[model samples]
Target: MKVLVMKPQELHKLELLLPQDKIAKVIKKLGRQISEDYEDKDPILIGVLKGCVVFMADLVRSISVPIEMEFISASSYANGRTPEEKVDMSGGPEISIKGRHVLIVEGVVDSGRTVQTIIGQLRQKEPASIEIVTLLDKSKCRLVDIDIKYRGFDVGDDFVIGYGLDEAQKYRNLPFIGKVANE
Candidate 1:
């Protein structure tokens, strides 16, 4: 099967949604905010594996303070595409977040279900602070209504991919964010 992204007369272009320069500016701005917030403290950034890898990498590099980075692999995808399934989290295979300032970096926030589950699991460690940071903030379909401390972008009701967001495990290498065109 093939995918049709755009039609000449569709009047909507993927390139218009998220510009490359804006994306860079937003990421750098967030990094500055984080640096100021933890100027005198050592912050531990926890990157949710797979999706958030690219965003986490960029954010960590931009941060101007000494910080530790860790990885946490967890999944909440259940059968099909229905969003009512309970997400299952995997205990981080390496490193411990106990008594650390944990900033969970994610690709995007849609329903907030998967991250919510992960946060619950990590709560047992009693970290000094647990905050959520996502590259894309979709408030239109947020089910849990969680406050994303560091949001790179606030988008509308559109399916977005690229810049670490993927359709089916692809398009993570695209420099700018794009949305699927609807017929």
Candidate 2:
């Protein structure tokens, strides 16, 4: 068997899905909703890196309510695009979650196994509430049930890249989301 490597330039050949302007509009709206919901309570936004880095940054700035930010590295696709049986996680928030509202921000959600695991772990810390906010939702690929309180866009099962979502650790810096061609 031989391995086929994709050239860097080929990554640029993507079909545009979510443009930058539209993404910004949706994020602003989500910010308003989240601010209103957590106005009286202190909410901690836990970002799932490294995909959530870009989305989380913009989202935090858009919200009117005061918020704390934390990050954890978790992935079901540790070695490849396809998810594995178990999710690998590390670097949880140092801040105590007990009695505080928690928001898990994700760049995209598919099988939901990883998010479910994160929720279970946080629940053990006894947060006042736990909610999910994802930039993109691929409901068609969901293998487990997860409630998302805030969502920026609903997408199909297409493999997307850009705006923090990567293809082979590339195309993450693109400002817009695009579907991988021939994927």
Candidate 3:
């Protein structure tokens, strides 16, 4: 899909990576799969915030099972394209994760540092189980090994924006995902 953003020069610099319809289909499929898998488990859907907000919102609606939702803010992209070795995490879930099945939703997995840190921290809470679901996976850029149970797309090493992913905190509101030009 081609988007002709006549006004915004930044938008014009983007090339479509994944269209909205494809993303929606992936989300719906994932939601159904999660609902089926955790039908009786009553898992908690923990969204990695800022980026996961849009994906989480749509994902929960597609799910047909009774579930709880929470948010955690973690980041390693404060300075550059490549993630910092360390991650900063804040605003964890209010509810206890002890003995509960936890499903973490992330918008993108690049270096795996931030999510790895989050998993390590969540492990201290003694949750019954922990799984990760990500919208975009860039395995080529992974610095550390991590398992993503559910993945929407496995993209090459490109700076992607839109559909809750961003660069410098912009383009996240776009319904479709795009690869940033000259990145």
lDDT tens per residue, model 3, 37-107: 89999799999988999999999999999999999999988846678887989988799999999999999
Candidate lDDT scores, in order, read 0.76, 0.89, 0.88
Residue 131's C-alpha lDDT in candidate 3? 95
Model 1 TM: 0.85
| Per-residue lDDT of 87 in model 3 | 93
Error of 1 at 109 (Å): 0.7
* Residue 60 lDDT in candidate 3: 93
Residue-level lDDT tens digits of model 2 in 1-183? 212335556423577888999999999999999999999899999999989999999999999999999999998886567777799999898999999999999999989998999999999999999999999998898999999889888898888888999877877888989886674
List candidate 3 segments past 4 Å from native: 1-12
Clashing residue pairs found in predicted model 2: none
Q: Write the per-residue lDDT of candidate 1 for residues 1-183, one digit (tens) a residue.
A: 223343345443354468678888888999999999988788888888777987888888889999998778765544323345576666562677778888888887778887888788778888888899899887887788577889988887687777887655656777778876654
Ranking by lDDT: 2, 3, 1
Of the two candidates 2 and 3, the one with more favorable lDDT, higher being better, is 2
Model 1 weakest lDDT span, ten residues long: 1-10
Give all candidate RMSDs, comma-separated.
Answer: 4.5, 4.3, 1.9
